[model samples]
Target chain A: MIVIELSERQLKIIEIVKENEPITSEQIAQFLKVTRATLRPDLAILTMSGMLDARPKVGYLYSGNNTVSIISEHVKRTKVSEIKSMPVVVDEQTTLYDALVSLFLEDVGSIYVLSHGYLAGVISRKDFLKNIMGGTDIHKMPVGLIMTRMPNIVTTYPHETALEAAIKIIEHEVDSLPVVEKFEEKGKEYFKVVGKVSKTNITRLFVELGRQK
Target chain B: MIVIELSERQLKIIEIVKENEPITSEQIAQFLKVTRATLRPDLAILTMSGMLDARPKVGYLYSGNNTVSIISEHVKRTKVSEIKSMPVVVDEQTTLYDALVSLFLEDVGSIYVLSHGYLAGVISRKDFLKNIMGGTDIHKMPVGLIMTRMPNIVTTYPHETALEAAIKIIEHEVDSLPVVEKFEEKGKEYFKVVGKVSKTNITRLFVELGRQK
Candidate 1:
């Protein structure tokens, strides 16, 4: 896909079409005091970009498609699997202190907890801070005791779009999401944490998108 | 600015131009077995988008401009002032516990510490967790004693682009940046924290840009 800045004449054509629907090329050219040949390329660009629609014999109609849709299309096509980073995971039985050590070592905002090889809970710096301030014994308590358990955690799959994952982060007020794969055992469903998507990843992608060629 | 998906013929035209630089419209038309009139709009679009350079006497030269530059232009045009949110601030002398309370109440990842109305330091959730784990006396110690001091903070100005700010955040590996105004007094420079830009803000903007119209 290519992006083009609409020329003044092209923009004016859109305005004219919006004001007068079903107007033919001859009428538009006459209004602009130019021949149909002169207006041909402008009309072609407007129609090709979906800004205007041309009918059988009925000239042009403004399609109401705006410039923002193009950007939206570009962003939504990026899948989460393409940008997701490795997650910091710890077994549910690990002590809170050990988990905190791993968090610092990995320099991640959050860590996923697993039980029997399935995602059981997620913990974050904020959770650990609150617990420590509340006098919870980090050395003795298992990470699972204070974690936000599964079924309450927001998650994204490898196939999900980055846009969808970013929306979840904003709406749910979470720092990161666990990218998981679902499995069935004894007619029960469980998610296995595979990777992670965080605001850091999204911000990094934004930087990359904004980088000049 | 408007974005349009280049038609198959346009893509072919670009490929042809790349393989054979300085090719005229007539030659391109002959190669495609179409009249020059039929290729007018395609040539207009290619030149207009800067993907091809047309010299007065020299035909068409592939410009090497890619699709990514358009997105970069759109993202870079957005300034930091347009999206910065209210910053959470605390006085340097405030006890660490009180500042943590403010951090929780505002639900922000970082807090700016002020000294006599000037930015003096910054503290994040990780900082607090580390201090707590190290057995710092949160109730007795002041925020200044444990915060990342001034001259070390990564900051942004209102006039700077969001893309520039996001780059700083990624490079510094920080969660947020204090939006500040620099002032000089008695030959010493200081910053007055005005607002904040965070990964959350960048992610939110990304979502907005990606949202379907």
Candidate 2:
């Protein structure tokens, strides 16, 4: 994809077209005080970019589609697998205290809880804090007790676009998402935690995109 | 800015220029079996976007800078004030338990602590979790005792770019930043918290950019 900053003359041409629809190219050239040959390339760029509509035996009309759709195309092309980070996981039997320890050690916002080596639930700092505030015995209670159980939890896969993952996070009001791989056994569906995509990952990608040359 | 997907002919023209440096327009047209008139707009686009360089009496040369710098430009132009959300602020004397209550009520990741109507400290869920794990008296201890203090807190202004704020969050490993306005009192610098910018904001902006038309 090629992104070009429209030249002054081209912007002017667009303004002129917006004011005078169905105007011929010769008329535009006359308004701009330039030769038809000189305006050919500018007209080509405007028409090709879908900012203007050129009709045979008629004239040019403003298409009113001059915004950046290409930017979205670039963002959607990035897949989840390319930017996911290592997930912090603990078994369902682990104590809430132990899970909190893992959270601090890993410096992550949330932890994935596993039961029989498959994702059962997810816990986060907020959950631990609320349980602590409620005076729950962290040492005796397993993380699975207070965790947000699966099937209700939002998830993303390797092949999905990062844009899709980000959308899920925002719409669901969650800080992180577990990137999982699905499995089927005895007519039951299960997901294995593979990676994690959080607001941190999306923010990092935004910074990277901003710094791209 | 106008973003366009380059036509097949324009891309072909670039490939030919890359292979043959200082190639004339006439030579390129010959390679593509098209007249110079047909190739004029393609060459204009290639050269104007800085993907190919043209020199007087020297023809066109591959500039090797075909990547999306425009995307970064677009991102940097967005200011922090345009996207900042209402900050969750509490007095330094407020109990940690009360502060946590405010956090839950506002549904914010961090809370800004104010002293004499100016920013004095900042606290996040991780900080509260850590203190709780260490057995701090949330109901008795004031938030000032454990909050990250001012001058150490990273901040952004209304005029600063969102890109700068995102960079600070990544580098400092903080969840959020207080959008502050500076004050001077008796040669002492003070900051009043006006808003908040977090990874959530950056992620939202990313989604918006992706959804831009």
Candidate 3:
């Protein structure tokens, strides 16, 4: 009946440990992009919470029970804001050719449609493929035409649990979900694009939970 | 001072457990696309290995120590040949524009250059951007002229450890390393493309290792 709330950095540290146990604090600090002193407090906290075990010379080891349940709870209780990746976005007026270049340059599978900082829609690889197959003028066509429009776009609030967002990805068969926040302006509800979640994020969660330290 | 050899299926099952503990055998079978009866032995083996704790209702719990060390060792001992993605390849005679289309279509950062099944060179995203920005005629240009030819291509053997391959990625500052096998023909050395290992692959390896019972 022990419930521990872990920070994102803590979760990342767990993944690092899972990948390289018996690893020294120096190595952990290097991976975390922090000083060893800065990581010391976090390490102490994890060890105290029984999520990690530290020895004089053995470095650290996993020694937790029901870690899966903890992970499941983490996915259920943690907010989307905590784990979402920076959303790749584009203006609605961007040309298809420019969008294509952006996609390749950014190394992203999809890009969010943002019009004046508002969530407008989403454009995916499939959308591009379908459009190209139809022989649309890539140089002249705007991305807004081919993007999956809002209301049809599946989105989650920043406060929602990651599990809920993850379920959306599976159910919709989409590679990512944009995390949004709604606001009222001129009696109209509009969503502000914030972040994103992908299969990679879920897999990373699983990797963190898999550790026993 | 303990060594454990885990099969790919076993590793996958561990991931499932980490994501959804208190999960039933039937559910695991469904996820694995196998019969419950077929999964029973694996469940039993895991439960007996001190890696899992099973109960009538609570299902399974993680119960292992030094799992990270074991995973690190797993990376060091396991051969790249056992876990590599199918190489994305193209012929040297292929046009640069066609190669560009293939790169985006395949969603790969780099492609292997093959000449009659022999590894000849490699073409990456940078190469495409450089050539395109230089105003080369994409329609008439062959990929061979722009490729990083043999003796410059970074490669790993199927027999090498994943850890070694990962190190190569860091050292060479490449997104992936092509797995190849060397052979001699008519007093000349040649390489045959087999597989590939990218950051995604290494991350996947870490995820698999993070799992407990």
Best lDDT goes to which candidate? 2
Per residue, candidate 1 scores C-alpha lDDT tens digits across B1-213 of 677778899999999999999899999999999999999988988888899999988899999875545473456678999889999999888998999899888899999999999999999999998888788889999999889998999999999999999999999999999999999989999899989999999999999888745
Q: Which pairs clash (backbone N, Cα, C closer than 3 Å) in model 3?
A: A51-A213, A52-A213, A62-A212, A62-A213, A63-A212
lDDT of each: 0.90, 0.91, 0.72
Winner of 2 and 3 under DockQ = 2
Better of 1 and 3 by TM-score: 1
Candidate 1's C-alpha runs over 4 A off are: A7-39, A50-67, A70-74, B7-36, B50-66, B72-74
DockQ of each: 0.57, 0.66, 0.03
> What TM-score do all the candidates reach, one by one?
0.85, 0.93, 0.49
Evaluated at residue A128, the lDDT of candidate 1 is: 90
Give candidate 2's chain B TM-score. Answer: 0.94
Question: Deviation in angstroms for A168 in model 2?
Answer: 0.8
Candidate 2 residue lDDT tens string, B1-213: 677788888888889999999899999989999999999999988888889999999999999986666473567689999989999999989999999999998889899999999999999999999998898999999999999997899999999999999999999999999999999989999999899999999999988888776
Residue A109 lDDT in candidate 1: 96
Order the candidates by lDDT, highest first: 2, 1, 3
Report the lDDT tens digits of candidate 2 across residue range A69-165.
6473567688999999999999988999999999999999999998988889999888898898899999999998899998889999999999899
DockQ of 2: 0.66
Question: DockQ for the candidate 1 complex?
Answer: 0.57
Instruction: State the lDDT at A196 in candidate 1.
Output: 100
